[model samples]
Target: MRICLVASNRFAIREPFAGGLESMTATLARGLAERGHEVTLFAGPGSQVHPEVRLSPLAVVEVSAAAMADRFAPGPEWVADHHAYLALMLSLARTGAEQFDVVHNNSLHHLPVSMAPALAVPVLTTLHTPPLPLLESALALSPDASRFVAVSEWTAAAWRHVVASDVVLNGLDLAAWSPGPGGGPAVWSGRLVAEKAPHLAIDACRAAGVPLVLAGPVQDVDYVEREVVPRLGGEVTYAGHLTGAALARLLQEASVAVVTPAWDEPYGLVAAEAMACGTPVAAFARGGLAQVVSPDSGVLVPPGDVAALAAAVVRAARLDRRAVRAHAEATCGADAMVEGYLARYAELGQRVDAA
Candidate 1:
């Protein structure tokens, strides 16, 4: 099958991935290509994908999330740039419709979903984030509304009122995230934003009497200064935006991975990655974390309860590392994700053929 993956233009679909969406897009593209399916990834300029997958740049130059933030307070540049990116993606999708059997939209923008009815081929929009006003409006205006998939059951439930979506759990490339010898410090990884609540992880790990390592792009600098910076040092240290081997190593070496999400996270990829690395997770029971973290692989506590999270860290540390890795291999491996998506694509193909 010839597949085209439409990625968000916010950042290149490369290492040191902007977030879960980009990582998932890259993984799916590579997995499909490895399966001998022809895959073309439509992403930002600096994207580096698998050799088997073709790359299609949506923008001439890569744009950083920080740059995007800078434009947000000044004027309409941010909005204009976003619209331009979306426009280009839609134009490419429309023009290249006949070249691919399926167009999987992971852009997380409303334009593709809004224009799905007019596309020559089927457009499968994977909702990676919760439904916002813009996305809800787009879905309401969409003529063909049956081509949406959600990353998790929790995410699907959030958008059930807007559009019926099937749940396809996100997966990680086991080869890249395979287990390593444990006995390292506790770890927390994700965008350093208020919503992710990395500071809470620091507090929990500290209370658990475990050293903590923080990793990932700092999405909110002000939050970092006010909440994260002051608390750094002693047992807590920031590893500064890690991906690929570095991130895998961090997860593998960790005694336990802490996930502190303030919002209803659509899916907790970090938790899955930690499990894949033979490390158990201590996550808040919010959104999809409960679904992703099986009892054998980790423990979930009430959200915002630092003391409970700390106790979970201690309990999770004693879990068998092999069990965590085994659970991840069985449930959240990339093969499962690719297979799930392939099934969806085939179903959509049958509908298109009948039409």
Candidate 2:
């Protein structure tokens, strides 16, 4: 089957990933190609091109001076993203049927979901974030425009009021995030924004009497300066945005992985990645992280309880590393994720036949 994958134009679907969405997009594109499916990835600039999959860069439209001069004009970034998805949808509407069997809208944008009905090919959308006004409006406008998949049951429930969805847990490459010997400090990883609350991880590590290493792109400079910079010292350090083996090794050697999300994360890929490395997690029991971190693999405390999280870190660090890896193997395998999508695609095919 020829498959078209749509990812955000915000960041390229490449490492070091901007976040989970890019990483997931890359994984799905590679997984499909490895299984002998013809895959075409529509992603932002600088995405790594694989031998098996074709790369289609999201076209960036140059907004005219007159358009920008308008007081009501949207910001440049918003305009760029809107135009890119809009152009892709129009192209698919025109000639997609001749080229692809299925189109997977893996992006966070509303345009794809809103414009899906115009395309001749079937569109399957994955809900990667919480419900948004634009997206909810799109769903309301065309309730059955595309089949929807949510990354976790929590997220599916969050969107249930807007539209029902199938829950498909995100997966990681267990091979890449292989088992490791754990004896180091606690670690925290993900976008260093206010929502992630990495500073809380620092506080928890301090209370637990364990050192902590924070890694990932600092999305919010103001938040990092205000919260994280003051906390960095001998016991806590920031390892500026690691990728590939560096990030994996950091997770592998950790005594415990700390996750503190102020918002309801749609899915905690960081927790899954840490578990895949045989690293025990101690996270606030929020969103999908609650589902991802099982008893054998880690510990979860009530959200925003730094002292409780600190206790959890100490407890989770003692869990058997082998047991943690086993949980990841059982629940977070990339092959399982690939198969889940294939099942969804098959269902979509059957529906098209019936129609």
Candidate 3:
């Protein structure tokens, strides 16, 4: 199948910016290409061309005036956001959409929904994030849109009231995250934001009498300052943004992995990645964490229960690391992930062609 993928324009695809959404987009595109599907990707300013897939950079426009207005006169914050969304939609529409068998839109923006019906091919949107507003936008704008894929059952459940969408749990490259031998302290990676609850990981580690290594970028400045920074102490070590060898090193040196989300996470990538590394994940049982974490791989506790989370961490410290590694290889590997999507694409493509 010839596929066109639309990625988030917030940052370059190569940039270690956003979590799951971009990573999944890139993963699917590359995996499909490797499987002999013709694939093309539309990326933002920072994304570079890949030999496996054709790349289209969205037309960039200067927004100095709008930036100034947003910075000073903040009447309605959604104004600037909506404006940018409309601009991208218009830019893509100008080029036409008949060039591919399917257009997979990763941007959950409402404006793209307006172009759904007009596009020559079916629009398969993967819902990556969930809040009431995003759910409402998706339902209101794309009510008739078909082939909706949710990254987790929990995410699908959140929007079940809004739209009927299929659930396809996210996948990772197990080979890239293989387990390494012997390390110290627990690791916490992913967005340092309120919803992710990185601070809870630090607190839990302290309570468990273990050191905490903090990584990932600060996604929410205000939330980090208010919740995370204040709690950082000798027990918690801030490792900052990591990539390539640095990221692998952090994962390798960790005794265990921690993911404590304050919100109902659609899918917990941190826990999945840690599991992939053959490391035990001690996370709060909420949203997709329940789906990804198994008894053999890690322990799950009630969300926000610090004592339960801490105890789970201590429990995981005793479990065999080899078993954790084996579980990730079998269940969450890239090969399994790629095969699942290939089947889905074939099924969806047949349905679309028949329609």
Clashes of 2: 0
lDDT, candidate 1, 95-179, per-residue tens: 8576888889888667777777667777798989888887788888983644888999999999988788898999988988999
Instruction: Assess the local accuracy of residue 322 in candidate 3 as a C-alpha lDDT between 0 and 100.
Output: 88
The C-alpha lDDT values of all candidates are 0.87, 0.91, 0.75
Question: 1 or 2, which is superior by TM-score?
Answer: 2
Model 2 Cα lDDT, one tens digit per residue, 1-355: 8899999888887789999998888888888899999999999888984578899867778889998999999999999988899889999999999999999999889999999899888899999988999999999998998999999999999999999899888987788999889899899999999999999999999998999999999999999999999999998999998885789999889999999999898989999899999999999998888788899999999999999999999999999999999999998888999999999988987888788
* Prediction 1 TM-score vs. true: 0.93
Strongest candidate by lDDT: 2
Candidate 2 vs candidate 3: the lDDT winner is 2
TM-score, model 2 to reference: 0.98
After superposition on all C-alphas, the RMSD of every candidate to the true structure, in Å, is 3.7, 0.9, 3.0
lDDT tens digits, residues 33-134, model 3?
A: 887888878766667534688886555444567565765554344454466556655655655445666777877666566567666566777777774575
